[model samples]
Target: MPFRRKLLEQTQRDIKRLKNKGHKPTTLLGIFLYGGTLGFLFVVPIVGGAYLGLWLDELIAGYSEHWTLNLILLGIAVGGYNVFRFLRDKT
Candidate 1:
């Protein structure tokens, strides 16, 4: 169909444009390294938040898990934002 041909042509053009924009094909090792880095970025904040919360809880005494839970949630939010920003910037 004419429509299908047009779509294919557009897709090819887009691919060409992307290629011209310095988008090199990535290797498997690069992908794995990116994945590992992303995972570390997402996890470090969470662990740090948990540790800080635990320390705060120890210092405070009465609330117990209140600080820990709140900080963990905050960490997750921050980590998600961080990952989003990283991906956005890289892309």
Candidate 2:
């Protein structure tokens, strides 16, 4: 069998196992919390960073150039590090 096929088979098996385990309320809640946190972890930083950059630009009002870009890059670096850490833990 191909690698993809094996991966799919394993995934189905895991799903079946979870279902067979009775899908307790706590288990479902845990899954939802994990998924929600993952989503927020990925999205919040970019949106918050953009807002912060815009606010900073307004406050400084041309005292220095490229400040917004610098803040955006910092946000990207932080978000990228988080994603890297998540993937590292999975592997």
Candidate 3:
């Protein structure tokens, strides 16, 4: 059909135009901000875990640091996983 042919021609032209265009990040500030955000995302959980773990350990009123240590390790693992997932999706 003539209509189909015209539609196909238009799509072809659009594709060619798109092929000439480049999408990239060219801003230093943007790069730093994104990096900071990624770092923040990765650090918050660890700090939060540390705080919570410390509180939990204090509740038992003892000289043991099992909860604090375990939670801190858990936090590190969670932060690493979060950063990994974020980078995977973003980049």
Name the best candidate (by lDDT): 1
Model 1 global lDDT (CA atoms, 0 to 1): 0.91
- Can you give the TM-score per candidate against the true fold? 0.71, 0.49, 0.75
The best-first sequence of candidates by TM-score reads: 3, 1, 2
lDDT of 2 by residue, 1-91 (tens): 6999999999999999989877555678888987776676667676777778777878884665365677777777777777778767966
Question: Residue 52 of candidate 2: its Cα lDDT?
Answer: 83
Best-performing candidate as measured by TM-score: 3
Q: Tell me the tens digit of each residue's lDDT in model 3 across 1-91.
A: 9999999999999998788655654699988998998999889989999899899998896687888899989999999999999999976
Off by over 4 Å in 3: 1-25
Model 1 off-target regions past 4 Å? 1-23
Residue 31 error for model 1, in Å?
Answer: 0.6
Residue-by-residue lDDT tens digits, candidate 1, 1-91: 9999999999999999988878677899999999998998899889999999899999984769888889999999989998999999998
- For model 1, which pairs clash? none
Error of 1 at 73 (Å): 0.5
Cα-based lDDT at residue 54, candidate 1? 93
Candidate 2, superposed: residue stretches over 4 Å from native? 1-39, 62-65
Let me know the TM-score candidate 1 reaches against the reference structure: 0.71
lDDT for every model? 0.91, 0.76, 0.89
